[model samples]
Target chain A: QQPVQSPQAVILREGEDAVINCSSSKALYSVHWYRQKHGEAPIFLMILLKGGEQKGHDKISASFNEKKQQSSLYLTASQLSYSGTYFCGTEPDNNDMRFGAGTRLTVKP
Target chain B: DVKVTQSSRYLVKRTGEKVFLECVQDMDHENMFWYRQDPGLGLRLIYFSYDVKMKEKGDIPEGYSVSREKKERFSLILESASTNQTSMYLCASSFLPRTEDGYTFGSGTRLTVV
Candidate 1:
């Protein structure tokens, strides 16, 4: 089944912060985060394994709670370049991965 | 970096016409997937192939079929195009155990059926 994402859309000013959440009904082996700009393909951001670890890169970070089957993406001190849509993909196992509906984020200058 | 390439950036087709969308990946990934992106609907999986001649029906597989005759290429076929199928079609490829590094997606093919 496809995962669910919260907050369909959000608008923030430069240097602000935002959070996007994704939850799955079934147990997840891993969670992937991606961002897509207008008229472009989605780009991979990071991946969190089932070990319930937190990973960070630049001002973006994510946490995966295997027990809850949920993952959250944190964008700290958001930049204008961060304006785009964020999607989380949940992989129940090695066979397939399903993506969330996505959250639209707009960061203004 | 892995590169996934889709044949067309935009396409227009008439109702009842057969449409083919092609995807090629430079990396010899073991898995390839086809998804359709619609407004507020996110990415809906249509089909996926794990290896040559191996196919699986995804969540939304009706009206869509897939072909993977070779390892580097996977194709999506619309038996009879309909207006409702007009959307952005995305192709993605990943190594075995897809969650490893995540999927590398093609730029997408925007199809408009009339």
Candidate 2:
């Protein structure tokens, strides 16, 4: 099943921070984060496996709560380049991965 | 660098016509997936293959089929193209299932059915 993402859309100014959340109805084995700019393929950001596991990529980081079947992505000091759609891919115990609807983030100057 | 390449970037087909979308991964990944991306629906999986000659239907597989004759190439086939089938199709490959390694995605093909 596909996960549900909150704050379908968000707007931020440069140097601001934003958080996107994803929740799934099924138990999760791992969670992956990806960002896609307009007309571009989604790019992998990070993958979190164990409960409470957190991984960071520059100003972006994500945490997975296996128990809660949820994951959250944190974008710190956002830049204009950060404007894109963020998707969370949830992998259940069955090893099937499905993506959330995604959160549109627009970073302005 | 690992690369997942989709054969077409854009395609336009008439209704009732058959269409094929090809994907190739050079990383020797064991898992390949086909997904269609829509405006607000996100990416919906149509089919996936874990090995050559093996395929599984994904979340949305109706009106679609897949081929994995070779380990590196995966193809998604539309039995009969319809207007509703128009969308951006994406291909991805992963080294392992439920592994820490993230998937490598292709640029995607924008298909339009008239």
Candidate 3:
């Protein structure tokens, strides 16, 4: 099933913060985060495993709640480089990975 | 760094023409995937391969077929192109399920069926 992502689009100023949430109806083994710039491929960001682990990359971080079947991506002190469409890919089980509709973030100068 | 390359960045084909989108990964990963990205649908997996000569249907595989002749190459074939098939196609590669790095994707091929 496709995961649900909150805030279809967001606009922020430089150095602002934003959060994108993803929720799935089924139990997820892992939740992956990716970002795609205009006309570019989606780039892998981070992945949270089934053990309820959290992952971070510089100013980008994510937390997975196994019981809630949800994941949240936190962008702290967002930069202009963060302007893109963010997608959360959920792996319910095995090797299959399904992505969310995506959250478009535009950070202005 | 792992490199996943798609044969074309843009392609145009007729409605009834056969289209082939090729992807090659140099990392020798065990898994390769083909996905299509539409405006509001996000990335939908069309097919995936675990190894050479092995293929599996994904969530949306009705109009597509896949081929994995060698370990590094995975191909997506559109038997008969349609206007609905005009979208951005993406390819990805991964090591295995147990790993945490997840998938490395190609730049994508923007295919247009007119």
Tens-digit lDDT string for candidate 1 (B14-112): 999999999999998999999999989899899999999999999999899999999999999999999999999999999886545789999999999
Q: Tell me each candidate's TM-score.
A: 0.98, 0.98, 0.98
User: Over 4 Å off in model 2, which ranges?
Assistant: none
Q: What is the Cα-based lDDT of residue A4 in candidate 3?
A: 94
Local error of candidate 2 at residue A14 (angstroms): 0.2
- Write the residue-wise lDDT of candidate 3 on B15-112 in tens digits: 98989999999998999999999988899989998889999999989889999999999999999999999999999999975477888999999999
The runs of at least 3 residues in candidate 1 whose Cα sits more than 4 Å from the true structure, single-residue gaps closed, are: none
Regions of candidate 3 where Cα sits further than 4 Å from its true position: none
Q: Residue A51 lDDT in model 1? A: 95
Q: Choose 1 or 3, whichever is better by lDDT.
A: 1
Cα lDDT, model 3, residue B29: 93
Greater-DockQ candidate between 1 and 2: 2
Per-residue CA lDDT of model 3 for A43-88, tens digit only, reads 9899898878888899999999999999999999999999999999
Model 2 chain A: lowest-lDDT 10 consecutive positions: A88-97
